[model samples]
Target: MTTARDREILRLAVPAFLALVAEPMFLLADAAIVGHLGTLPLAGLGIAAAVLQTVIGLCVFLAYGTTAGVARHLGAGDLRGAIAQGVDGLWLAVLIGAAVTVVGVPLAGPVVRLFGASADVADPATTYLRIALLGTTPLLLMLAATGVLRGLQDTRTPLVVAVGGNALNVVLNLLLVYPAGLGIAGSALGSVLAQVASAAAFVVVVVRAARRHGAALRPDLPGIRAASRAGAPLVVRTITLRAAILVTTYAVTVGAVADDQEVDLATHQLAMTLWTFLAFALDAIAIAAQALTGRLLGAGDVTGTRETTDRMVRWGAWSGVVTGVLLAAASPWLGRLFTGDDAVRDLLVPVLIVAALGQPVAGVVFVLDGVLIGAGDGRYLARAGLVTLVAYAPVALALAALSAGLVAIWVAFCTVFMGARLVVLVHRARGDAWLVTGVVRAPK
Candidate 1:
């Protein structure tokens, strides 16, 4: 017998899951379409895609900040304030997006070269990166708008828009890339158009909601400033996390740990792929934590917020356990799906087991992360993120010297990096400092 709380969690998480899935699918579609363009274009696309993802990923705070702020106001019965904050987020997104495009377009060639791409690959990579940067505003707008909807407890709408947008992208890429003979450029154009359409759709929905609630629709400078301030720490937090992953990748590529560099690299990549997929599933619960916790705080219901936290932590733990069990059970077969090389498969098996065992910890960490974010505790999260990175560094460096092979490296990641994060997050979540009531605000 499911309780109301269970139902509420499902309501938010299920749609959020689909929405999250759609985001990666957009990139998957691009890869599939561009993969057939020959090895050079595909290679270029890989580099360009990595750069684009990192750039935009750093701005994910636009959505996270908007969601927390809007949800807080709405929970306090201040619908107008909620709508106004969302508008500010949207405005900030556009401004930042434009700035990124201006700076990135001219330096596209240099940027690709920094990644050590050869001349043959750098040209197309620069071209794709430049073109994709053109859609930055639309992409940011869509992200902020989706955050707004999530804050309003309307995940279904974003899910629908995301699905439709991806579908449109596939059709557009097929038409533009093939018949139009635009090649990789067509793939960029198709993605840009799809982003625009999705942003437009979000605008329409947000406008109607604003009108229905008698809220303001235009941008407000003060609100935008506040949103930007609130998001600054989150941005730092995100960049710090990304740095850790990149450092690990750097270690793998430089043959820092494994004797057989290529085989170890292949195994690490496969394990990371599975790990990332599991993260997507776990993040759905985190999204729920963010939305619900913010609302509870705004309503001045500290007890309710605490209850929600406990419940979410339990949910996260069980979900992680289930995911780990499944991954472990499938470990033997998982390698076959990605590779025919038995050597890679052998290296991947133990690494997958390490990842599987760490899922419960990952689940707990992610949920606490969302809880803090929704509580508008970005300052602590940012500081903690840096601290975690510092702690992980020694462990990571030891791997290079120990030369303990690929499995040992993954063990370090699971126990050291993620383990440190779990400690800080759990401490914060358990404390009352993140239980503030009233409207969510940036630190003075």
Candidate 2:
């Protein structure tokens, strides 16, 4: 990542950064609105979000997979390959999202119940979860579009689309969740609308780019199928990770109840929210790595990919440290946003403190995850992520039993994710032949 390459990467990453950041903005809005509704609704919303994310979160890899495959194709001077993946990615995303939308709507309540949310909490959670599930298709499309843009080294367009959508979300949330009086359902509606807008924007930009590049978005079927094949490993990895994280939420929630404390749940949710913020923010580096490194690999510039990945990892670490410090400093005010009860705030402070401390490690894990995905090392993602997430389940319960509350839970979380990433990243970096070769390997 020389200065010139850094600039080029930034040109793509910043937009991805902006768009991804917009995600939490919407979540924060939901939390704020639901917070105003009181403890039950807020808790329910948190549980709903967790459940929905578990089932649908795997779709997230569409962005990374598309970027890696498309960028490599472009780098290899195969505009056709890039277009094919883009088209196929869009179709694949739609297919998965549609299936989820259908299956999830019926199972929403059971999913919430499995998380041990109270009967009172389950209904609202189900309501919110179902609506959010509807947004999955558009969300995937928007994400996949970002991949296409990143491949072309055109990050700004996706960022603009994301911001535009975020702006729409904020407006909708303010209107629907409040004066309009839709309650939790309003939150879901706002999210879906925002995603739809962003997806539309991405499609427009992608179509325009295809025209400019003299490629067709309507890729040939054979090319689409081939690129689609290239994307499967990453999707499996993403879905596995999502499912693992989803189960952890249930474990944490049940443990909180068994520990005989309401604050346990609240505090953990607050800490996770903070974690989400840090993870999403620092993921910009990961996105940059995936885009640029994949481009280099595609172009047969293995040396460049190696150099850029190293630089991005360093950058991610530094940024994570800064973010941790800032988050720790802001914990007092941030805790108040979740709940103002002194006891709850007390529980929250320690959780945030430890969580903030782990930001650097978390950042490393995330950045590395993106790099590997970009490099097409996603086949092992399911096993790797499951190891990390599952490691925390018993620890969460044990900590809760020890009256350790949220701090212990987060500590366990840190350990699991850190340990899991440690092995996978090392394996890849150390020349694991099976996983090290990216999607865009040079012709023999």
Which candidate wins on TM-score? 2
lDDT for model 2, on a 0 to 1 scale?
0.73
lDDT of 1 by residue, 53-123 (tens): 77887898988888888899989998888887888888999899999988988988888776554576677
261 Cα displacement, candidate 1 (Å): 7.5
- Give the per-residue lDDT of model 2 (tens digit) for 219-242: 456655655666667667776566
**Runs in model 2 lying further than 4 Å from the true structure:** 218-228, 257-262, 400-403, 432-444
Instruction: Name the runs in model 1 displaced over 4 angstroms.
Output: 31-46, 117-127, 174-186, 256-274, 327-354, 397-409
Decoy 2 TM-score against native: 0.92
Give the backbone clash total of model 1.
0
lDDT of 2 at 407: 65
For lDDT, the strongest prediction is 1
- The TM-score that candidate 1 achieves is 0.87
